[model samples]
Target: MATFAEPLRPNVASADVQLPGVRDYEQVDTEIIGTLKPTAGWFGALGVAIAMFLVGAAAWIYQIYWGLGNAGYAPPVMWGVYIITFVFWVGIGHAGTLISAILFLFRAGFRTTIYRCAEAMTVFAVMTAGLFPIIHIGRPWKFFWLIPYPNWRLIWPNFKSPLVWDVFAISTYLTVSSTFLYVGLIPDIAVLRDRETNPLRKRILAILSLGWRNSEPEWRHFMKMYLFLAAFSTPLVLSVHSVVSFDFAMALTPGWHATIFPPYFVAGAIFSGIGMVFTIIIPIRKFFKLQHYVTINHLDAAAKLALFTSMVVGCAYLIEFWVAWYSGVAAEQDYFWNRVFGEWWWAAWIMLTCNMIFPLSLFSQKLRRNPTWLFILSIFINIGMWFERFVIIVPSLSHEFEPWQWGHYVPSWVDMSILVGSFGWFFMWFLLFIKQLPVVAIAEVKEIVPPKLRSHARGHGLDPSGHHLPYGTETPGEFD
Candidate 1:
């Protein structure tokens, strides 16, 4: 028995050679770049994003110049928007890594184009997410004290603390996520490097590509490295979020303490992350004309994941209620009751509607297939997920055991600005990424689209192949 070699299509070198008018690679490239370039609307969006960022920046500056007193983080509400946004952004980062790393490990073909953008979102969102802890500290300058470094001062971070655990977990997550994102982007960067005519662009891409020459050996090594990174990333996805959940579970707070927090938080993270992906990608696909690559099929698949995770999240919610009542813990029962019928009843209802009811519509295949509906549903899910985080963080902290500390907490302008600004920061990096990188992985797209599908237009006399050939005409033996 003879082993068959993998199919060989055109590499980056052959990509430059045009097949006459059959496919205007230049036009396609132009369209791709054009979609990425900031248009008038993008500029407006950028301005809003920048303004929000500056507002958050100015708030942090004031916090640094003065103290944490400016941010409304009093004794009771010590963990305010900072921790809330931290968890929120961390949750937002979940779907990207899970989709890219885990799905890739399972050889999910739909991830080819979606994963690149999703991974980019993961890295940037995590970066933004990591900032909250630094800003949340009263003395922001002493942020590094969280690290257990050998120092002349003979000071060490408390390893037993959940906050310290968070530092380790988040840092590890950021490092691993960034590594995965950069590794996956190298091949695409090489393609850009080859196509780039400008010296500066070429030089930058070349360095980013790490001297990749697009050789068979290079591609082979790249694949192995990427696979290893993906494998490494999969566990980090589970562990990092689990560690985050521990921050709450290990606490003595009635609603916060629970063994189920890990899986529950992870599911909510993935749920929110998918919502964010859809929110970003839907508009991008339309504006960029990436319909072929980011088709309804991709959206449908994402919707399915979103719906599945939503169900998991819903189950978690139900279990939390059941456990609180069944445990016979008076405080826990009151806390759970207070969550639903208490002052924060509105937040609980919002969570139930967004996480459970809204996503339930996706059971209808038509709703999931419709892009407009998908976008609407995604927005609702995002809002609901945010509410879920807010509900988890605020009510538990606001209404603790002590009657004096059982005061209601409301976000000030500073808190609201910072929260909204985080969205701006996320979108800013994401928009910049779309402009710089090939939003669609061209090589991967070519790999996935069947050889027969490639030449269908040619057979219909719509392509410039001249001869009415069957599929795989231009590259006959190559595809085989």
Candidate 2:
């Protein structure tokens, strides 16, 4: 709830030697590592997050004892909140890959300010998402049966089924994302190791650092491995979401079957993911007094990204409707009509407003740069995207096939509790992470700070002299 106090470097010249957010290069570590030490407010937020997770855990326990009857599922609409949320969280995980991998490959410098936290979100978002399928299954104890494994009976899991793909895709995604996050942290961890005065903390940091000495040979190998992993991760980000879309598009059910789904879902995933990053990083910058590090310029770039993706998604919506009209498919036409005019019509309208209408506000540079507006719009996008998934899943199921078989589904308390809990679990992990590790990558960010700034600051006695600095210093270079 705290606000940014430092004036944003909006008109900063292109030729400025030092990056806008940083002054002396050596101060990057001190600025970032301070976040590892928590305040009372962080503890308070952590408590709330833990409480939310516990609420969901209690609901799951109750459901386990009472069976699926404890949930909202019934008749034609057997899938409800869990499936919607699964899609939501999975979509939320996409932006991290977009920022950390795709943008890195393209050589974007802005990513340095935000990629660490974004990557953390990707890992935790997937962890939250991986839960729903298990929770949705009537017998979670047998969820492992979904996995392909050697057996004496010689019966393998269904390779043709997208359900099986979900199992493999999500597990593989979590593994790669976790590795990406830890790999990025190694250099920062070594920084922590060197700074620590306590013996026990140093030992833990040493184990985590794997003897990283930041030597030239080590730096060469690290960059190669990091880029190799990024290349490997690039396709997985695309494929994992495409496979998720297949879960629906591969089905022939009314609104579910379509060629547009793969791209639509991917765009929606990135759009929602970017929105969430805004929702997160805004508070982080404000509360942690990181305005200098995460400037309005950084936020503006992200807002532009969210706006572009939102328009792409908005076009996808129009295309689906146009295709339905042009194709003359009765089921598809009925599904679209029902979505707009039938039961849960409110949801359809809400989704359109959130995903299509609200994002249009970002077209104004004034609104995009306004932190308050950006935060509100980001929350709206997240909510709208969630209902977009709900509208897609539920209406189709509610009106499928024979009128006699059709039935409506309503969310039970269990559904609401688990939904709230999943959010809690996610933030809980994120808060703990920020408390224990540098929220931004100190090394990557330092690469952008002009060495001249440090020299100039030293000349003015604004910072300590170069030789006395402990974080290692680089000599200043003249402009080309």
Candidate 3:
């Protein structure tokens, strides 16, 4: 077992010039020391989160006891706030997957710190999102009826039904995401287990670490497994969000039946999800004094990604209107018009302004670099994205083809309480995660900012990779 100060040098390089890629494997020990210290701000955040969780839990219990009728979901508005928030939270989950999986596959080096927190967010957000459909079910107890089970009942979920598709898609996504998050945490947990002298903490971490011993072979296999998991997660993000979009597109409702729904939904998901990443990360970084690691660079990268996705969402909005007008479908045209000038016109405009126009400011380098502005912009994007979901779900169902069936939908108190509670629920889980695990990837960061390597390479006038033999491999003491 190597100590934190014992640096592992490449055989070819001198001891003083630290090589990149896991030089100080024991740095994890120092990192865990800070992570275990309880802070006032963390406890404050946790307190609020717990309160919110309790409120949400009580609301859910009420729903279970009193039934779905309490939620203001009548015939015309079968899907209300629960379904809308479900889609909203699920969309917010996309950015994490995109950041962690897609960017990793592309070798985006900046993702190292960003990916861990975002990936953890993805898992918890999905878990909270998955609860909506189950709670929305009128008979919550019979939720398993949607599954294909071999039993005396001899029944199967309808494969053709979009709702059933959502069940399968979201379930599969949650499973994969949770597995990915847990796999990534295993080595980090082992680091904690090795460092902790406390019996309780050591026992807990030992169980979670799964007998991991930081051997070269273990690290090699873990890296390969991580790469494989990343590959698997990339497609899952795309497919899960697309399937959610299909839930609406497959419907015959005028506004719902559009070819553009898939891409539009996915882009909006990324946009909102990235907004959430900033929403959570900015505060966490500031509170924990992790600015050195989280850095302005990470913020800039996330801002750029959010800006691009917002533009993509904006384009989707334009294309949707064009398609509605050009397709010669009367109902579709009416639906489009209703969105802009009808009862919920304000919502459509809010969505456009907040999600599209506001985030566009990030196009400026100044705005992207400004943390305060970036945080505000992210909050706006989140609000707008939520409104976007509300607009899509409600207005379409509210003002359908049949004038006789047309009705306005308003969320009842139970719905509002639960919606608010979900935010608390999400934060509760996230707060726990930050406390219990390494919020930043300790080993990965050490890999990125290897000490003495850059100075040595530069002194020898060698490239960053340090592959130029005599030119790159300086005597370590000279650089140190």
Candidate 4:
């Protein structure tokens, strides 16, 4: 609403940033809220997502019925694709919080157009990631045992296990991030509520909006709450993935046992997360015709960040080999050597090329700005990152202490089906979300658009729409 608009202010690099072309608050609402109206394509995509998820659900049901043996869990390589995907999805969950919470803290304007989708991606990715642990345990029903509750039998989870650490880290991150997302959505939801014609939908929106009236007091409290959540969620950008990295760092396995795991994993998580964001947003931008709001400049900024993280990840890769060779430890050196030149050499090379080499193309401004090129590269990044996890987990576990213990791990159809299903499960939720809510934040985007004077602001405490303008007392010159 016009009442929610802040005072006119100059946006940074006003020339370069592609601010939305809308001239008034009403246009912003029309353009954004208008996207919620779904079409045939929306239903078609939703159908595909549901189909994929059902196929995966079938695979999971079969796995549960037959047992974990149906999976690709060979002797030495007990971890297999389940564990690899668990880590990958966890890493994928990082970018949303980083883009939303960390960027907000730094006052990055580019994030305003993109953070809402990224935040949703974070929540859904985590929900997807949470499934793996239960699946890996081969017992979905007993997952509650991981919780530290007062059980009559006094049985408890091992606190030292990194899996336990993941439980706490992921659950905490999910709670805070979702709450942060919902809070930010309140005002925008209020906007939808005020504009809705249907009574049924209006009632639902009202309840979700918590009776928001767009009052000065509400805006004041909202700003304060958002700021606090931004600050609170920032540390999680680094900590959550760092805790995930501990799954490997704290392990005695040669490839996994390195102090660099925390920062390295953190960097890779952000990189992969950004890649997923690009993958999801690019299609949405095209189909939804939201080019003005989610512009090339926003993609370019995201590309640059992805490129930066790629470089960090590249350095971490080299440092891994350097550590292995420099330490002169036979087992560690052998493990590193076997990783690149061993049975799973193809997987290793894919990791190297996708995660490290391919991203280098982003250094070129042309490639970074081109949406098509960026989308392709994002696909490569996601593939490479998944293989990166595979390389870390399977290789280390397969070729361990004794040559007799070494084994080749190949994923069964069931394992592959579930992996395919995870993507389905994630996209299903995301597709439903876009149709149900505003993908772009109406209030934040308005903040970037330069303000204007309304007739009601002329010595009257109201805008043209009869909504109370917070800055109506100020003269037109003050806005300038």
Candidate 5:
């Protein structure tokens, strides 16, 4: 392995420089793989995550024992924090596929450093999102009824319900996203396997790596399949969120009925997902000392994307009010009015400020390039996105057409515990993931590194191909 005298440093320049701050193949390996090593902080984080998850699990058990009524189920606002959180997690999961698949297809260079962790976030967020439907249904065990199973009674899920569509959408997203994530990990795991001295660990990695030898045939097959998956997964970025939106747009309720919802939800999902990517990667870059790989240039590019989505989301908000007023439907206009100034006005304003107002700061070039500011902005965006969902779901359900049915919802201790637990659940998986596997893609990182850095002979690096591959060569690409 080729070694550099200096450790990798964060790149503060424009992302126009391809794979900025990365040098030899071994530097990528050394820095990214180093994150897998155990530290006191890692243990401490894991302990906190475990405790949070256990508390959430306990809250869930209590909910199950006491029934769904134990949640903050006000009459008109039957859907509360659980449904809001479900949508939030689903939205959070969107950026991963967008970064990994859509950005890959577009050949975006900035994605090279950050896409691995983003993809992981997608899978875990979806996993966390999946739990809410079962919890909300009040019967966790019989959740299989949502599936199209061939039972003796011949009962099947309602094809008309958007809730049923969610089952298909979330499941398909999870299946494809999980497969894509694991496929990308094979080569990286092979690197870990070859370097392992522990017999048991080596054996486990060997199995996970699926005999990845980086040979010519393997690279050919790998690149072809990767391209295919990227193409296949690209449509999913648009479709999954659109389907989630249908849950609202298809409804007859005053605030819920809107044609703009599909695109509106899609944009919001991307915005939130990117916000989460910043939240996760900034810390990983700082703590794991992976600044060179996940540089300021990369984050600046991401901030730009977030800014673009923020505009789209802000526009959607304006369009919602415009359509309601323009249509002149009393119920529709009333619902819109109540959403902004009624019982949950504070939540609505927070959503507006966080999602629309705060993100405006990213338009400044300096803050876009500053990791600290970007991190702080990303936190606000996530919080705003959460409130965005809360405002959307709760207000609409609470203030429906009939005045007699109106009611205000307040989340119980159970609701709050479960909500907090969901974060714990998400972080627990993410923490375990970073510790066990390479958080950055080794093969993909090598693919994007500048040609000047590709000085090694075939045997000197992770590539099993006979010779060093150039930047543009498709054959024996990462390995050759």
Candidate 6:
């Protein structure tokens, strides 16, 4: 997601060199660390999230008492709102990994500012997504049975099941993303450890920092480990979501049988996740006064990314329908046609309008750069993407062959409460994260910027990628 940047200048020397946006090294630390303090607004937001979380808890309890019937789960549509919500959150989780690991591997330097919070979102979103499976399983206490482990009873998971693959895929993704976020934060934590005076707080940060010393050896090892982790985790972005898609693709259901499922799901996941990223960062950037850090340029870059992924998803939608009709498969054709013209036709059109038509607005530079427009459109994209999963899951199931067994699923209050609560769970974790930690990566931002900026300096003028920067010219629409 490279933004428009000016052409590079070659005359700058070591101490005078700086990234185009930043001011100085000392100020970078102050600005980033300053974000951790809790304000009244922060607490107010947290309170709402906590309240919603409680509502969800109560809903779960009621569901337990009433059994799965409370969610309107039925035979043909056995996978109801719970499975749909699971896939939605899983898609939302994809943006963090995409922006953090994949963009890093691709060397998109602009990602440094947004990656920290985005990575944190990945961990929390995955946690939220993971819960749906447990919730979907009627026996919550027996959720542990999904794990394949050696035991006295000798029970094991179904090795061939996509559900089993999800356990591994999501667990692996969470572990890697958490480690990546923490590893990237060690230096910043050490900085906070030094900045704070309290004995208890300093000690905990010191432990978490693993004794970072700003030494060449420490940096050398850190870079090595970071690179290795980024490379290793990159493929999981595609694999994890592909496995989730397999939960549908492996089914014999007409709409679920495409070989295109893997890439299609991956594209939609990135699209929804990028939409979510904008939804969070735009306000945070303004409220936290991080304008210089998460610049309009950065937002422009992200909007472009959202547009790109939306197009990919839109193409996948078209291809799915075309293939269904082209194959002359009665069941597949019927399932797709019912989606656009039958009982669930409304959901299909909503998905197409939101995911495909609305995203084209970003092609206008004015709209992409306008924060208010960006925010509103992002919200719509999120809603549209969610409906995409709904239409995909429901229509096929509701209009399956032998209309006698066909049925429509409507979520009960319990289902809606839990669904809303999942969002609260995600936001609550993020709010706690913002209050306790630097929302941006201090060290990575400093890497491209020079140690001193107001003086005539020597060497180190080149970027981390070894390109000499344009010192004075301010050009737009170009990037490394």
Q: What tens digits encode model 6's per-residue C-alpha lDDT throughout 118-223?
A: 8988889998999999999977889888888889988889979998999999999988888888888889898999898889999999998899988999999989
TM-scores vs. true structure, each candidate: 0.88, 0.91, 0.89, 0.91, 0.91, 0.92
Winner on lDDT (5 vs 6):
5
Q: Which structure is stronger by lDDT: 1 or 3?
A: 3
Task: Write the residue-wise lDDT of candidate 4 on 47-77 in tens digits.
Answer: 9999999888999999999999999898988
TM-score of 2: 0.91
List the pairs of residues colliding in candidate 3: none
Candidate 3 segments exceeding 4 Å error: 1-33, 451-480
lDDT of each: 0.79, 0.86, 0.81, 0.87, 0.87, 0.84
lDDT of 1 by residue, 376-440 (tens): 99899888988898899888987788777687676767777778778888888887778788877
Evaluated against the true structure, the overall lDDT of model 4 is 0.87
Q: Please give the RMSD of candidate 3 to the true structure.
A: 8.4
Off by over 4 Å in 4: 1-20, 454-480
RMSD in angstroms, candidate 4? 7.1
Cand. 2 Cα-lDDT: 0.86
How far is each candidate from the true structure, as Cα RMSD in Å?
7.7, 6.1, 8.4, 7.1, 7.0, 5.0
Error of model 5, residue 457, in angstroms: 16
Per-residue lDDT of candidate 5, residues 383-469 (tens digit): 999999999999998888899988899999999999989999999999999999999999988886643323345244324433333
Inter-residue clash pairs, candidate 5: none
Q: Write the per-residue lDDT of candidate 3 for residues 231-311, one digit (tens) a residue.
A: 888888888888999989998997898888888899899999999999988887677766655656567667878888989
Q: In order, how many clashes per candidate?
A: 0, 0, 0, 0, 0, 7
Better of 1 and 5 by TM-score: 5
- Which segments of candidate 6 are over 4 A away from where they belong? 1-21, 453-480
- Once model 1 is optimally superposed onto the true structure by TM-score, how far is the C-alpha of residue 44 displaced, in angstroms? 2.4
Compare the candidates by TM-score and give the number of the best one.
6
